[model samples]
Target chain A: MSELTGLTLKAALEGLAAKRFSSEEITTAHLAAIDASSALNAYVVGTPEKALEMARASDARRASGQAGPLDGAPLGIKDLFCTEGVESTAGSMILRGFKPAYESTVTSQLWRDGAVMLGKLNMDEFAMGSSNETSAWGPVVNPWRQQGRNADLTPGGSSGGSAAAVAAELCLAATATDTGGSIRQPAAFTGTVGIKPTYGRCSRWGIVAFASSLDQAGPMARSVEDTAILLRSMAGHDPKDSTSIDAEVPDFASFCGRSVKGLRVGIPREYRVDGMPAEIDALWEQGIAWLKDAGCEIVDVTLPHTKYALPAYYIIAPAEASSNLARYDGMRYGLRVEGDNLTDTYEKSRAQGFGAEVKRRILIGTYVLSAGYYDAYYLKALKVRRRIADNFDQAWQTCDALLTPTAPSAAFALGDKSDDPLAMYLNDIFTVTVNLAGLPGMSVPAGLDAQGLPLGLQLIGRNLDEGTLFSLGSALEKAADFRARPAKWW
Target chain B: MAIDAATVRKVAKLARIAEPESRIEPLANELNGIISWIEQLNEVDTDGVEPMTTSVAMGLPMRDDVVTDGGDPAKVLGNAPRAEKSFFVVPKVVE
Candidate 1:
């Protein structure tokens, strides 16, 4: 039972296919693990009954030889994706107890593939903050503690809960979204593998909106192969999402372990920001060495506008968020805090329902998009976004993919950077560039930092070129052989 | 271009998020800190660059303007915080 929950998604699927273990057994094991994982605050809601029901249906499918690609696999859904009968919170108090009448397209596809929903994982409220502290349910504790210390660390955000759950084996794998570094940064922090596929790779119809142009759904798992497998099942062209790329979903898992000989892996010189830990820089150097050893040629590339990505992201994301979030006006769904008038009701509800960080972003977004400041902040940021994308376009002429350290440093203790918002925004420094460029970016656990916490290496790929990232990431994964797990204290 | 507490108050109102008297100043300070930091974008000369509205290569696909879905008002009102007769109940706006 203990070992059953430890199987990766690929292994679990094969195990189910071979009838080595029924999904009900695996689901039961994971449900028990989730019950014991409350200390980590990984999941905001548990659907044990629903999980069992889905597992039994999966088992019946397998028995009938009608299994799908991900048949009989149990996975955790991020709170942001609405599940038909399950409450999807998006990690905000305002969305409490609001169950969707329909399932998100991505999740509906997962169910179509016979994936089981263990529960909704926590996240930064409305996917805003870099640290999970902004979650209305309270901050999710990083499953990894610094060696021989009792202090808690953040698993990074806004996919913090998904990373922690995957790291702690609370689920086989999880579905996560990225707007600006949400998936990759959290995956880097927790030593899991996560990929934010190319902008149009997956349908965004039902995942709660953050920054529409930047938001994408992807997979987080324990291994490069597992992440690839999950991404294959998670991605496809959807008519519902107008921006969704009308393309075939590649068999991503097959790309893992493929040769990368003569592949140009670019190392962006602009990523070497000041004050980054030496170990992180060293890990990046080691990553380059590993790729070179894997029959790949390393090339230096420059994303000149890289430094502007974070600021640009903060502006554009909040601007879109302000407009996207305007729908929550004490009306159709979720929490409602009444005031004397209709407008007052909206103000009071949003003020009371939203957490501090969310309110902060809303105000920033509002102010930027306001009458006078639109050109100064929002439009300026958009133009910077163009330059940033152009920089990537220039880099692609020289290299097939780019490599850098996933986060500036390993997971920091919660509350360390939360007080200072600018300090907190800096956490996405290494990962934000990928989002701004609307490209696929992935984080693979490559090594551990000095304190023995896991560190990750990021891989950036061109538009619709996630298969190459999977291949390169697998090479890094194989070279590093990062198999360390956080000590099971929870 | 740093904003003051009064600006924050007005912005919050614009955002339809009420800011309490005590919290307004702190929110202002936080917003100013972020805004000032963001002012660095000015250093990048984007004189001729067009704002990137999207990264997807294609324009949004056009579909017939037909009602492909909806009509189950009960389903629409299912998640409403307050509902009556398939209508979402809210504070009265009209006199």
Candidate 2:
């Protein structure tokens, strides 16, 4: 049962489908695991009834020969993704009473593909913080820590709960979104495999928009193969989402093979920033060495505009976030505050509903878009963002894929950089460039730090080339041989 | 790096979030710090650099000029703080 803690999504799905284990049994065990590890704060709300209902439905589907590829697998969904009739607060006080009447396309598709929904996991309020500490619900603890090394380490964010839940074995896999390294960073912190597919690979309809153009929903799982399977089920066109690509959803599972014999991997020279922890630098080198040993060619590539990414992303994402979040005014959706006048109502509603960090971004967002400043800030940022994407396009021509550290360092302690919002923003430095480029990216657990915290190696693929990313990520994961488990859980 | 309290107040008003006088100073200070952090961009010469906006390389699609939406007024206003018959109620702006 303890070893089953590390079972990949592929094994779990096959076991459930073959009746080697029942969905009821799997859900029960995971629920028990979740209950036992409540200290991790991985889950915002647990829905045993929902999980059982979905599991029973999955079993029925299998009995009736309707099992999909994801049949009977248990998955955790981040609170940011609205779950119909379930509390979907996005880890904020503002949405305390909020409930969506419609299911997010990603959540509905997970159930339709026969996966069990364990519950909504915790995250930063409105997905704003690099550390989960900004969550109105409180921070989620990283599972992998040695006794006496530190206390309450972050599982990264704003998808910390999903990563923690999967890392702690509360669920086999979890749904996550990456607007600016939300998915990949948390996966890096918690030692799980997380992928942010091409911008339009997954439908964002009904998802609580953070940064509409940058936000992408993907999966975090125990292995690259597991992540690939979840991505396949999650990807495809949705007429409801105008941005959802109409491209053919490839059999991502088929891409996982031992051979990368002639593949070219580009090591971006600019991503190796000053002050990066030595362990992270070494891990990147080890990852490169592994690829080299695997018969892949390594070449130095330059994304000259890399330094501009973080600043540009901050401006653009918040600008879009401010606009997207404008819908939350006391008029429609989410919490409404009563006031003497309509304007007061919107003011009170937003003030009471949003947390400090959310308000900060909104203000920053509004400032950049303000009159006389729009052209200097927002428009300028947009142009720099394009150059960053162009840099990636130039690199892809020289190599099949790009590689870098998912983050400058492994997970920092809870509240380590929480006081400094700029420090929090800097944590996404390595991951946000992919979002700006609208490229596909994945984080695979590369190695462990001195304290045994997980280190992640990121793989960047060309637009809509998730197949190649998965293949390279899986090949690297096999060679790394890094397996992680939460210290106090079992 | 410190921004003026007045700027913070103005930004708070634009954002529609209430910030007390005591909080305004700290908020302005924080915003200034973040602005300074982002000021790292000034060091890099973006002489001819074009700003990237949307990550999607292709153009955002525009639907045909047809009445495609707008029938669920009730549902839309169901969560409204104050609504009148078929409309959201608001304070009068002018006499």
Best by lDDT: 1
Candidate 1 segments whose C-alpha is farther than 4 A from its true place: none
lDDT of candidate 1 over A375-414, digit per residue (tens): 9999999999999999999999999999999998899999
For each candidate, the DockQ is 0.90, 0.56
Residue A30's lDDT within candidate 2 is 89
Error of 1 at A440 (Å): 0.3
> Model 2 chain A, poorest ten-residue lDDT window?
A1-10
TM-score of chain B of 2: 0.84
Give, for candidate 1 chain A, the lowest lDDT window spanning 10 residues: A429-438
For each predicted model, how many residue pairs clash, with residues at least 3 apart or on different chains?
0, 10
